[model samples]
Target: MKAILAAVLGLALALPAAAGVTIDAFKTDSGLTVWHVEETSIPFVALELRFKGGASLDAEGKRGAVNLMTALIEEGAGSLDARAFAKARDGLAASFSYSVSDDTLSVSARFLSENRAEALALLRESLTAPRFDQDAVDRVRAQVVSGIRSDEKDPNAMARQAFDLRVYGAHPYGSDKSGTLDSVTALTREDILAAFRSTVARDRLYISVVGDISRQELGPVLDTLLADLPETGAPLPPVAAPAFDGQTVVIPFETPQSVAMFGQPGIPFDHPDYFAAYLLNVVLGGGGFESRLMQEVREKRGLTYGVYSYLVGKDGADVWLGSVQSANNRIHEAMEVIKAEWARMQTEGVTEKELKDAKLYLTGAYPLRFDGNGPIADILVGMQIEDMGTDYIATRNDRVNAVTLEQINRVARDYLKPEQLSFTVVGQPKGL
Candidate 1:
């Protein structure tokens, strides 16, 4: 569960790059819409449900409510305590994973086709009638607090915290979804209930199912599992305007290796030049060691072990971000090389060969995402959340292939401003 769930966590936006598959879209009698794929090859089913406004829906001053609530949902349900719930779920050999990010709460379920009814019934209980007993709440809260405390002493986490603070300021996106110790310690059972009622409602739900499930068969199941939720949820947070200034901030930490996070504003998923920018990023840093950032900073200069950049498109904002770590004495050199690569990409953009290579890897890698039912289900759900049409899976590579060299260069020049890159470094260093 941990391994597979962690893999999917990295792929929330992975539909743009999935293997070929078909999607069936329908709305249940209860006004619940679901996108499904009829794959009868395997006698198993994978269902993914994404509810909008995740931890961001936490009430003001009750920052970690949604996160803690999500954790507790699988702890106990209806008449079952934690032990009973786990026993029931494992008895059926079913799997359920609940996770929350800044934008959404995701529920992923996998179970044998024969056990579908029982598994979904148990899941329904968890969703609509989570016990949230004081004991369960205390246990999960303690785990969350422990993780938060551990992050305080982590250099990479410290850099990320500093970077988010500078970019998002007072916006919900700026803070950890898990909340501070004081806030989590102050949370009450009522706060957890409020977060649940505000988020696990029908109006915020998006679902996708795959494997041995027919559209007709799935419609009723959808209502059974979801119809009881509230018809609406709390309003989403306002759009964030990320602030990416061209300055370096260094936080002194007692670590041998310094970690640095850098970023600038970026385009959204729907922007016309988005595909072009995506390809350009592959050339810049996202292509692993083949990327210019890796080549210039690691392979050539030996300044850092690795340096990579990626485009992050969240519900409220989009930004170009990157990270690197090096000996305190060499982190400055790594930063200099990264900035130089950034400027070079902006001015020269990607060459024809670089663009061609990026297209090959991105197109080739997308199909692997359809290796099984679970991946297909997750991809389809992400596509729905991003509002991509059903045809996206079939014609995705076409879109990637259509990004011409001219388009890539134009997007690079317009979007990648080296002068605007902000650096947040954690750990003691000899020089700036």
Candidate 2:
């Protein structure tokens, strides 16, 4: 009897577990895609809205317009001034903010379910009817311009900007996500309004709501908030894959630590090999102290305090980046170590122990990403924007676990070529 009972228990444990949270997704009548995760454990709710055109959609000469427009949305919208907007949101104890990334513009709000009406009202105003007051635009532009000047003084920032220019060339991805000082200075209220009008259409929008709310309860709220938005806008043109010619960009800078950035074109988000590439990056450099790059470069040689690598998966393109900082004298050695590691991974590949450890860390840390409503909302929005299925959270572990040694080696051979990488070192080399 004991043996039989133990057998049954073991079999049950071996079965794949279901996701702790389940997402119910559908499209709103307004042509907005909505994803809902209902968790009554908390009394609060979180909402996130994503729009297609981010910095990548900036016009040829109007680089910072999208970003500046996103900021101004929260500054004043509908009939409220910036001060009135703040007071109203604070009175309701709601948290509302907007941000523009390379690929998307997002607005998020977290508030008690009791205050959902007010929160949605404010969010709706910010989304569809932003004032874009001239005063607000001028104020935000000054801040953006100041930030650009500040970046100019930072060696690491200079290194990355140079790397982007070299790796991406004339591609839109090559331009700074934050506009240049000249570009920001050239921007006007007209530019911001035009960008907002062109980008934030209903069909291009995705909304995700998580926390103590059901789709039935939330559907009406969404309808009311998004009612004024237009159903469609101009579809974004497809972005081409960045071609990386083996080039070295050396930008002279006076800093104690030389910043080195290097990378090759990588797989986009929708690629079949994405899971393999993701796991490979973890084993290569994304795993912090346990990563091969950190273990090889910093621990053994004392070359730098940290070294890391990652993949950027955008709507139309992707790129791999590896970065480290070291004394000017050690920059070449550091680059050699990076290149050697790349070659080794491509040829010899990772061992079972390395692969297993990476899987453990990735799976174990996955739940920590949901510690707050804000992060949970962000993840949901990202899934909708990336076209990743609602089951992504549930299947993410399986995806990482499915990456076999054979798959790793095959992907490494296909994607990780050392000679094809472009290197950018920003600082004076000791003997250059």
Whole-model Cα lDDT per candidate? 0.90, 0.81
- What's the residue-level lDDT of 359 in candidate 2? 89
On the 0 to 100 scale, the lDDT of residue 214 in model 1 is 90
Model 1 TM-score (2 dp): 0.95
Q: Per-residue CA lDDT of candidate 1, range 256-324, in tens? A: 999999999988998889899999999999998899999999999898888999999999999999999
Clashes of each: 1, 0
For candidate 1, the clash count comes to: 1
Q: Which residue runs does candidate 2 get wrong by more than 4 Å?
A: 1-19
RMSD of each: 3.6, 7.9
Error of 2 at 66 (Å): 0.7
Q: After superposition, how far is residue 193 of candidate 2 from its true place, in Å?
A: 0.6
Candidate 2 — worst ten consecutive residues by lDDT sum?
8-17
Report the CA-based lDDT of candidate 2 relative to the real structure: 0.81
Clashing pairs in 1: 19-367
